[model samples]
Every structure is written in structure tokens, then in C-alpha cells.
Target: MAITFSDLHTEKGIKSLDQFLSGKTYISGDQLTKDDVNVYAAVVEKPGDSFPNAAKWYHAVTSRLAPSFPGNAQGVRFGGKAEAAPAKAAATADDDDDLDLFGDETEEDKKAAEEREAAKKSTKKKESGKSSVLLDVKPWDDETDMKKLEEAVRSVEMPGLLWGACKLVPVGYGIKKLQIMMTIVDDLVSVDTLIEERLTVEPCNEYIQSCDIVAFNKI
Candidate 1:
């Protein structure tokens, strides 16, 4: 349940983690695409399987909740500093209403919304925040750095609570191979393994490093 100094440094990885203890998007990077978030759910929520188009999210979700030893970044300690991993896979699709993707109604949420609206109208302040992903900056956009980044991916930890945080399942994708790659990223333990299994060659380390699996700590 211990969030390292690194995770806290990023705004997108763990949104207001100290102030908001639970909810999806609370800790994972803001740059995460819809697929990234969904894959996160499959890995932790439905570990041992990969649903299409959700790999990066799988990595982000698992790192925050991977079953780990105390003080380590693996295994999520849910319902406390970290939420506990659910004991069972959902019994049916109809149970969606029970999922708690965001935190419940609280005085803080109400006050914060009011304050934000007041600030916007009174000052008309337009804070300049950037989107999570900037296609222009992606290393893969440059072949040279991509190699180096994948190496970094191998060393990072992904947790499992991502499953609890989401409920995404892809029906299809706009691009074929890209969707396939997305599938590869969906398996927490096997994103890298699947690459090796299919390609019979190691993928670039940058593929790993460029990975946006890192998440915000919510405990």
C-alpha cells in the first residue's frame, strides 16, 4: 500500500491521491486512452486473460493492485489505504450497478464543484493543463528511442485493482494490428511474454518503457 515518491510526482498517475482515496482515474495517468483503461480491468479484474484493446490500462491497473508483499508496490490493499482485490470475478454482466468506479457522494466533492464553478465564473480563469498523451512526443514516433524505452517497461510493477476501477470490454477496433497490439498489452503477466511468444524475438525495451502502465496511488 506504500506509494513511492515517484508515483506521487506525476499529476495524471495519481490524481489528488492524498485528497481522494478511491476511484478510477484517481491514480492512473490521464494520458491513458480508453483501451488502456479497459485492458487494466481485464488483467486485474479478469486476470489471466486479455480482452481486446485494453493493454496499457491493464498494466496501469495491475501495478496498483498486483498481489505483492507488504510495503511493496504489488498486490493492492483495498478497502483500506488500498482497496482490496475482489474475491471473485463478477458472476454476471447485470451486476454493473454495484461497481464503484468513482468515489461516493461526499461533502468534499460538493464543495469542490461549487468552488470550481465560482472560480470559473468570477475569475474566468482558464488553467492551461495539457492532455495526457501528445502523439508528437511518443518515442515510437521515433524508432531510435523506442528500443531504449521497452527495457524500462520490464522493470516496472503493475497492480490488479485496475479491475475494480473499470469494466471495459472491447467489441472491435478501428485498426487491426494496432488492436492486436492492444490485446497483447491487456495481459498483466504476459504482455511481454505474448510478444515473445508470437514474434519469437524480444520487443524493444522502449516498447516497455514507453508503456503507460504506471498508476496513481489511492490508498
Candidate 2:
């Protein structure tokens, strides 16, 4: 029998999903489909570690839907409480026959196909791993030359490092800190190594007193 979850925002619904996803990769079958996307969109946040199965499923679906995950968290209503069971079967049947023999597809089918292709490309790209970072480059004092400091920070380069937009923000006194953005390939760059070995030492250190990561996000 197929399981149907309701009130997906509640603990009871999440637990049901967790149990359903145990030893499974996708919500319905072996491959990702609109069902996964719909259920994933319904849940408000990543499942905590307490729900190990659900949490794992969440992250797997997340990586699979990268760059195009839904922004909204509105709970999806499958059907009225009375029609839940049939709705699951109907949805599954629809997914199975999205494309007809003539190769004609509904607009919704086309969009879903496009999103699936995009997800595939994103998954492949993620194999190399990458992250976007924002760093706060501090100066020793207000007298520090902000222009030269920025130049020095940008000077240090590596195989995976690409510098991006930057701006200075007032600290308290006349001192201003440089907020810089950078993208790095995870395999080729280590933020800790960059700070401990490069930015906080030698030539770059002349203008940079210390460096702290303001934000780090996977791309």
C-alpha cells in the first residue's frame, strides 16, 4: 500500500515521511520526480539530525535540485482528506506518462523536463565542489591605506581563487574594514590555509591585520 502524508509541516507528518524514506533514495521510486520536488517544497526546513532518514533524504534532494530549488515553503495539499489515497495513485500515473508517442508534451511537462536537465547538469558540476565566500579584511588602524590594502588582498592568487566585488565598511573609529567576496573550488582551496598561511602573513599582512570569514556558502 502507498503511504500518504498530511500536515507535512508538523512533527507527525515529518516522522511519517522519515519512516517512508528509510532505505529509499526517492519519495516514490529509484529516480527523482515531481513528487520529490513537491514534498520537498512542502517541508519548511532541513530535517534535523534526529530524523536521520528524513535529513539524509532532504540533503540528497537538495543537491539534486540545486540552483533551482523552490523558494516557497507553503504546504502542498494533495487533495481533500477524503481523496488522499486516490490522489497518490493518480499523481504517480501522470508522472509515468508525461510524454506521449508523438513527442508532444504539456507546458508543465516541458518545464519539469527542463528543470530535471538543469538538476542533472548541476549535480555533475557539484562533483568538483565549489563555494562562495565573503571575508572581512581588517586593518591595524584608521591610518591604514584602504586602497593599497585592497590591492594586497587581491594580489594573493591561487589555482581556484577568483576575487569578486568588495566594499569598505566603517568599524568604529575612522577604521574601515574591507568586505571582499571570492569563489573557490573546494578541492583546490582551503579558507583556513589561505588565512593562516597567506592573508595573515608576509606581504599581504603588511596592510591586513587579520581576516575573518563573514559568510561561506556552497555554490
Candidate 3:
């Protein structure tokens, strides 16, 4: 019941926002209001294309809200590097727990935490120079075997390659999606080539219709 109500509330909110901002420059009026700030903060990480008016308002407000720094320019640096996409949806909610979101912290506390993590990661990168990449795999037809696809991806070889996680997500219409993450040394060129060649060689290619590198960055 709680989940149902939450879903209904979200649906209604999207509809209300779309209707309310039809002729307005901001959520409240031409001038900025607390309401606009609140909504923009809540959905800034979400893909803008899904909500036209909200996207426009979010970009317009956030562009002004973002602070400028001297050296970095970008105010904050949490993770080592940004992922290709923010991932509109995850295979599991906990999948992103390790990524810092600056939640429920005082300004000083958040800054200190980010600094500590960044320092630690910088040291590790100096030692290992490793990175991570996420791949999205899909089948061409109903006849394709999922087990083979998984086995094929698992079979790829790379020096210093470390398998992270693999999960299947149902994307509706009786179709599903496969996502896998792997860590590797600073050899993206070789790793990418190996994945492309291996996935299409024999048994793996028989099942996998398409595969793509969704996210790749140093961890």
C-alpha cells in the first residue's frame, strides 16, 4: 500500500508540474522561489529529457546556483571521475550506495569527507592506476540463450581484469537487459578490443545481439 501510494504521488506530481509550469518561467512565478529550488535539487541528477518544463527550470536555476572555484572550477569533487551516464535507473537501489551523494551532512562535514576520500583514491591510483567500466548486453531474438551470453562475457580475458557485478534487469515487453562491471588496469584500448573480438567470435556471438560500454572511468 505504501509503495502504491508513493507511485501515485510521483505520477501526480509529474502531471501537476507539467501543467503548473505551462506559461510560467519558474515553478512559483517569474521570480525564483523556494519551491523551484527544492524541485530542482530533487531532480537535477535525473535525465532532463523526460520532463521538458522541469528540465528547463532545473538547468536554468542550477546554472546560477552552481558555484565557481579558482582551480577546479567545479565546486565539489566526490568520485574520481564521472560515469558516462548517471543511470536513470539501476539494477538495484543499493548498486549506487558507494557513490557519494552529499546526503545529510553539514557543509564542513561534507567537505572534509570528500577531501579524505579523494586523497585516499589519489594515493591508490598512483599505486595501481586501475579503472572500471560497465557494459550493457542484449539479445537479438527470443532464441538467444541468456546463459551463453553471460558465459561469453565472463570468458573475456584481460591483464589485471577484475569482475565486479553482473545482473539481469527486466525492461518490459517480455525483454530483459544485462549489465556487467569490471575493473582493469589503464589498458582500456586492449580491454575494449578483447571484449569486442571475444563476444563475436563463436558461442558468445551466437546469443548476444548487441553490447556496449555504458560507463567507463577510473575508480
Every model's TM-score: 0.18, 0.44, 0.39
Per-candidate Cα lDDT values, in order, are 0.32, 0.76, 0.58
The candidate, 1 or 3, that scores higher on TM-score is 3
Off by over 4 Å in 1: 1-60, 63-103, 124-219
Instruction: Using lDDT, give the best candidate's number.
Output: 2
Better of 1 and 3 by lDDT: 3
Q: Write the per-residue lDDT of candidate 2 for residues 78-196, one digit (tens) a residue.
A: 34222223223224333344523223466766887889899998887678888999999999999999999999999999999999999999999889999999999998999999999
lDDT of each residue in 81-110, candidate 3, tens digit only: 323212211111233224222235556567
Total backbone collisions, model 1: 44
TM-score of 1: 0.18
For candidate 1, write residues 1-219 as lDDT tens digits: 112222432443333333332334423435333233232232222222232222233345444433432343332334333332322221111233343233365565588788878988766434322121111112333233432443333333343211122111222342111111121112233443433442223444334223222232222
Task: Name model 3 segments beyond 4 Å from true.
Answer: 1-128
**Distance from true position, residue 165, model 2, in Å?**
0.1
Worst 10 residues of 3 by lDDT: 1-10
lDDT of 3: 0.58
